[model samples]
Target: MSKRCLSSAMLKFAIAIMTLILLISFSFISSGAYAQEKISILIPEDPTFHDLDSYLDIPVVMVNNTDINVGGFDFLIQYDTGAVELLDVNLGPVDHCNWALIGHRPEIPGVEKIYAASGPNPLGCDFSYSTDTLFYLQFHIKPDTANECLTFPLRFYWVQCADGHVINTVGDSVYISDSVYDPYIGDFIQQDDTFPTIHGLPDSCANIPGGNKIKLVDFYNGVINVACIDEIDDIGDINLNGIPYEIADYVLFQSYYIYGPDIFNIDLQMQLGATDCNKDSTYPTVRDLIFMYRVIIGDISPYPKLGDDGNELIQPTALFVQDTLAQEVHLVFPDSLSAIHLIFEGEIVPDYSGPEGIAYNYDGIVTRLLLNPGFSGTDSAVYQGLFFTYTGDGIIDSADVSDWEMRDIASEVGVIGELICGDANSDGLVNISDAVYIANYVFIGGNPPFPLESGNVNCDGAVNISDAVWIINYVFIGGNDPCDADGDGIPDC
Candidate 1:
């Protein structure tokens, strides 16, 4: 256009540049000819915690720990369409490649996958990469109403894009690749408006080998495991039973104590069970356990506490020094005894009686049989009781309900029999009863998974009907034992 003819030196310079490009390409042809064993395209293994309908960003790493050297690269990424939507792809921070050719090969027949490639930048080895991030992918989690945790994978594929441009083997979009430098224009431009196969497909899709390549050991796919734990608003209603007091609620209480905040991280229903079981402005304590036991045994109620006259409200367990006695009570009770102090409540007419010395009384309540008549500060027998019932804000007396309620039968954290994980009943066995317990608890708000961690028979970390079915399969059907392999709870054998 400038009316000037090309100078000889300029022509020579252009030829030299082209010659150098060919030489560099051929040099890589040898360096990358043999696939190395250490080459691997890795996705993040740790779970990607993403919000529903929200975007999640993850890294695509390539750990090339071998002598293989390559100047270009390409691969296809596949994912579950229903669970996530791939939004965008970006080059990693390292000197991976100067430019990348990315497109969706939607023409493919089956699951969707993305075809991405990089290189040919006259710039020096942009990808002799060893342990580096290759690409960062952003994904949007599709909205679904799963009440429990679920895992979805993001893996690499060996798709042969077919038409020389990888359209059929790639994912869902129009293809773009071939590029070349124009001599007269003196700059690189799109010579063929199509994605080039210069970079071969993922090693597994090896029909067409590119000029530069790397041998990948395996497809280290990653996942985004989403947890859909619902938050319960009611106090002590851990299992979502209408009332806050039940065997199921107690089971969750044990889990909350053992796993701590992590359990809450999985289920927000424990929020009420944790933040304030008694509304005392404090998180759950043994006091809450005692309270839960009272409600379970029909001794107290979390509902509007109205007296018989329907006017005055009386909290049943006012006698025990409220709170601050979980461990102390566990330490009491040297051993099992017969005549235990049956401490219920004095607010109900100050006195009441039940079968076999099971009664609720107050105001000079303890006799010598109960606490040596005048003994205080703890009797020699540790609250000096045996086989007593504190099933109530209705039961516990001023004689320290801790010794009874906090016994190993299920202290603040555990139950009587928690040998393995599938024991939903905790009655020292895993059988139809445990399955029935989980089913009733999961479907009808009956009782929770006993031992808190026991009901996860399937080991997916949440107790549900699937676990009940697994128990059925193991019980009468002779399946794997209940112990999980992780050893976080007990031995697997």
Candidate 2:
């Protein structure tokens, strides 16, 4: 063979091998790119129960379906602002890379824009990716949009790889709709078959002995579930105040007896339920009033039976221990309760304007002090005085306190106790003087606070600088109220 022919043959063989190698590499790269190059907005299934003015959180997800490391991407999300207001955006785990909010624009009357980008430290750099949430968009459903389906559309401008390659990315929209019971999985199931069997029959189910029968025969193959109805019953809740029987309950019962149910602007059925203090399966009778009075005077326990739903009623207890030296009374609950309503019956009057004094709204007969905002698991609070010094000798006991009531989230009532807090100077008020007194007792050679526990404003067990600082902050800068570790409403030592 000639030299030229041999060289040409050798060149052709080398070219063929190189081409095969390139084809193999290209196939692997293509498959990896396809696998990792998609982004989506994930909307969770509608909650079992949804109401107007509720907030919903929707997530933006990136499905890194390729072998290439992700450097960055730009995203534009659009949603109906009228149906739901975009309250906030929260970063997700995938937001380790630097992210910037480009701009947010109201595109139309109902629609709005959220534009954001995530990339390398500077820009156009690569970061590895798997499946991860990129961010969350928090939205508040508008009242008018209740029962309506809302859609969130996502658009990805570009997804760049670590090697500076722009990959084609797929994006999806999320749909949020009101919760609805579906009779069938799809459009094909017949309504007759989908209807649940009521007592083994359909139309005549209500006439059956139990009204509806639920059977759990297949223990191995089936699941049995019980769900409590969300309705809260404040039965024996006199005054219809969403609490159990109290002094107000007696007054409300009397008003109902004298003037009839129409005298109060309350639901008659709810009132009847609440006013049934005796819970003898009857409503608005002289017997119920007498039972309520007895309960209020501590003659009989309120609601000594289980609720109509067969659940044990939550009964909270409240008590107060007086700090005689500080002249402050601290409200305490034996168990967790949300709110408390106290009535000073005799000559007892709580000083309502001092530092430790809690301001309250008065309804002539009773002075109301709301311990915490709404219903709280918090069971303690401190008030300045149990009785006004001028009105009486300032000595208060359970007798001077006409009524003490506590309530839980379900409006279940319990008993309450009283005590004192934050009055370090042993004065009748918690004020700048108390902070000064704590500071002097801690820093200088001064007499220690009357109740040493009150000097520990932070309730850290020691009268120290932090306690003085805490007291100063409470008196001047409006810091948190003194700590009550035991929930006894007293600043603990």
Name the top TM-score candidate: 1
Top candidate by lDDT = 1
Off by over 4 Å in 2: 1-41, 47-49, 92-96, 100-103, 118-129, 144-493
Candidate 1 matches the true fold with a TM-score of 0.31
RMSD of each: 27.3, 26.1
| Number of colliding residue pairs in each model | 22, 23
Q: What local distance difference test score does each model get?
A: 0.44, 0.40
Worst 10 residues of 2 by lDDT: 216-225
Supply candidate 1's per-residue lDDT for 372: 15
Candidate 1: list runs displaced more than 4 Å: 1-37, 92-96, 100-129, 161-217, 231-493
- Per-residue error (Å), model 2, residue 138: 1.4
Q: In candidate 2, what are the lDDT values of residues 218-305, reduced to their tens digit?
A: 0000001111112225766755666776666666655553334565677777777666554434454444555565576566565432
